[model samples]
Target: MPDSVLYSAELPAFDRATGQLSLAAHHLISAPLSFLDLSPPGSTLLFDQPPAHPYQQPVLVDDQPRRKRRRTALPSADASPADFAALRDKRDRQTTTDRESDEHHAGIALDLRAALEAVQQGWAGRARDEGWVGARDDARVQWRLREAQDERPELDLVGLAAAQERQTVETPVRLEPPRAHLSAAQLFNRLVLNDSSSSSTTVDVGIETSRVEPAPPALAALLFPPRSGFLMSDLSTWSAPSSGIAALGHAKGGWDVVVIDPPWPNASASRSSSYETFDAYDLWNLDLPALLGDKPALVAVWLTNRVKFRRLVKDKLFASWRIKGTAEWWWVKVAADTGEPVWPLDATHRRCYEGLLVGHYIPPGTKNVALPTIPQGKVFLSTPVGHSRKPVILDLLRPYLPSPERAPNVLELFARMTLAGPRAPSIDPLPPPEEGKAGTPPRCGFYLAVGNEAVKFNVLEREGGAVRGWIRQSGLEKAEAAACVPEGQDVERM
Candidate 1:
């Protein structure tokens, strides 16, 4: 993302099967803009449950009132003996496995803090001028602030869920609709790699839509939106290659590094309705080996804090996909305001850090490609942005690649950054196109966002003169409890 000029432009995903492109998946989102807002909300405790130890230290939040804990209903004094026994049994029913996992993770956080502090001590002086790349002391801190207004889109679309899971059907089966018109491979191929080292380039793929969608007879808004919802004429009008995006040629080759980020199932994400989450099988459908070009490439997966989620990737997914596992790294979220972890380091039920699993994906019969051995237990500190979006760590992982001269071709399996750019004060808005015509691309400053729903986060307005905000973020917003698993009972980090 270095030396790139990100512009506010529409990202059009293409389907080679029908040779059509659509923006429906990345269209106007009706969800709360607060989660996507540039301003970080007042930090609150993610877990309300008491810490594992009886003598746990009190946590005092900064610039915010302490939240009163919700009281559990107690058994009345007149209740039967049987009722009292049941209540006591339920209280002590936490499984042995759960207790062990919680204890294990609590220890892991302590070690991670120690390791991060060591790295910070070494890089503290140099990091002051450039920004907090790794870690820092009391010199400077970056706080997220939000602008008060709305940036509404004049366009919208609806599409079918496409997935038919085995879950039991209700009286009327409800399928969560999909966002893209193209398959993953087709979309990945169509992604434009714009390196603005010499000159800044922006390719706007603007299309026209009716002022208000004429509702179809099938209840398209309430039900699965039909595939026939889009017209061929609605696709972006593409000119010659060099005229729009020049360096798009490299997206074809087998990627030297493939980063797989799935929408892992999360309890918190479900309750919040921020975005949709999918099962692990949905991720398995993507043939991992096929994506990596015939070379000894590196593969990394962003993991949630849960042991089950970690095991799914490290145990089954990696081995089955032929990505020989190597090492693991932890991305600890630091609060820009406090220069401390967003969550308490020793909080029993929540973790400030998430997991990253890496490996050298050298398949059988491939030789002479000497990929570097990834060091184990690595940690990086960076402030969180926009609701637990994973920070850009490709630069950190680049060192593990076999060769530095040949900048590795990186492919993100699941990307959700906004493709739209920030409009500068001097720029004028392009006239909206007629209902059937493709419009001119808007002129604006931008962030380099590529992948699915890349425009979903566009609603966020920028903060002026803020120091050390994250540059690039890919995917993964998992929120399980600190450790242990029973599924469907975890909290999230905001």
Candidate 2:
């Protein structure tokens, strides 16, 4: 029997109620930290049965006492000091020799080179049986490296410094706040119009709205506060809006969870340029705790297999944010056809798995209540979708949420897609009340805000007792057109 255990199983079922997936069902192989002999001791030897023999004669022997050995006396007081020193030196040398000998025998070294070669041979044989293509060099190493760097422009430090200086000088001035007692609609109008003279203008919100660029669809609610719904956006360039802060403050107990997939920088990532990369310092400086609200919530961060990055997250990032890391789950990428690891388990360049680090946010003086423990080392098996596109693990995370009753105020930072789909629609105006009956305002739905200003807004709105969606021109063009419309005209509906 083999000493290590290799587990292979089916993927877990998804939980629709909580929108979480289980990590326990995936195939995972674990070995002992140190090698162990699984067989019974002395079982390797064969013993022949003794030939059937008869009786033996007994003989009487006389009992005699053996002489006792006498103990040596201690060195005499008159003995020379040099003699004592020599004796001590000899003993020390003997002890050192014994230690070295013990170390040599105690160290158990196993040569897995033969085993690895056998595995490779078996893999090759299996590939042949399965009619799969054998491994081959896809590209020349030298050419590949050169081609990756072809588009990278040479840096100019002097020009960059001058540009920074110019930006600092040209930064927009802060706007004053609107007057007190303004209604929500009035406040929204002032913020959207960039009313600089209003007495209630917040510097952060003002700067956010001053630019003609349209914010992400997810950030629409944050820029223009909504009663309720979901929101998703990328934090590549923009800071957290004031309305988002206020909304979180007013939430039942704040957001129930916040999942962040930071664009962690790496050499391979720089070559691909799939998304913008952020330095460790930039990720560390993000205000994650403020997004969680007043109540305790679960924080999950997706991580790569880099030891240094993992250390930064555990020792520095989470520590600074007052979040105690609880468990780590593995996302094992398997071959789509074979349902096996994409690469060998011990591949030198890449591992077959990535890690998800889960932590809990505990404020000071709060009761340190024990949360539902999630099993660590469980495998989340899934086939690769696209470059760095992770499958939604919200189903697996729902069980550990702070509140499981209602949909937890979930937020995904650095999000490229929402649970619904990519590119959420823009803000829709509530329909007018019906005749002879009080028309309650339509329940707000999920919101997704993007960072790019060029994408058109397909805002989902309520109209004529049904939900209707319309695609409007980008906010930059729409705002310009709105300025020329008659004061009483509804330019948004038009």
Best by lDDT: 1
Deviation (Å) of 406 in candidate 1: 1.6
Evaluate residue 220 in candidate 2 and report its C-alpha lDDT on the 0 to 100 scale: 18
For candidate 1, write residues 1-494 as lDDT tens digits: 21111111133434434576553111111111212211111211111111122222344589565664423346789989997888788668967666656765865665577755554454455444533322222121222334523243311211212221212211211112222122211212133322211121111121222353662222111101111010111011111232111122133223456565666777767876655566666555555555443557778888876666677788888887777646777776654333356666766456777788999887667766666766566666655544546655544555576554343445445555322112212124558889997553322222223333443322222233121112211121121111111111122310
Residues 1-494, candidate 2: write the lDDT tens digits: 11122333433434444577764433322111001121111111111111111111123346554443222223569989986887677557755445443342232111112222233343444544431111112110001121233343212212222333221111212222321122112212011212211011111111133354664222211111121122222342223444253243333335556677776787767997655566766775576666554577788889866666666786788887778746666666555234355654444345656778887887666686766665444454544434565555655565676654334445556554322211111145547768886543221112222221101111212123121112212222112101111112233532
Question: Which segments of model 1 are wrong by more than 4 Å?
Answer: 1-92, 95-100, 103-107, 119-253, 367-369, 418-451, 455-494
lDDT of each: 0.41, 0.39
The TM-score values for the models, in the order shown, are 0.52, 0.44
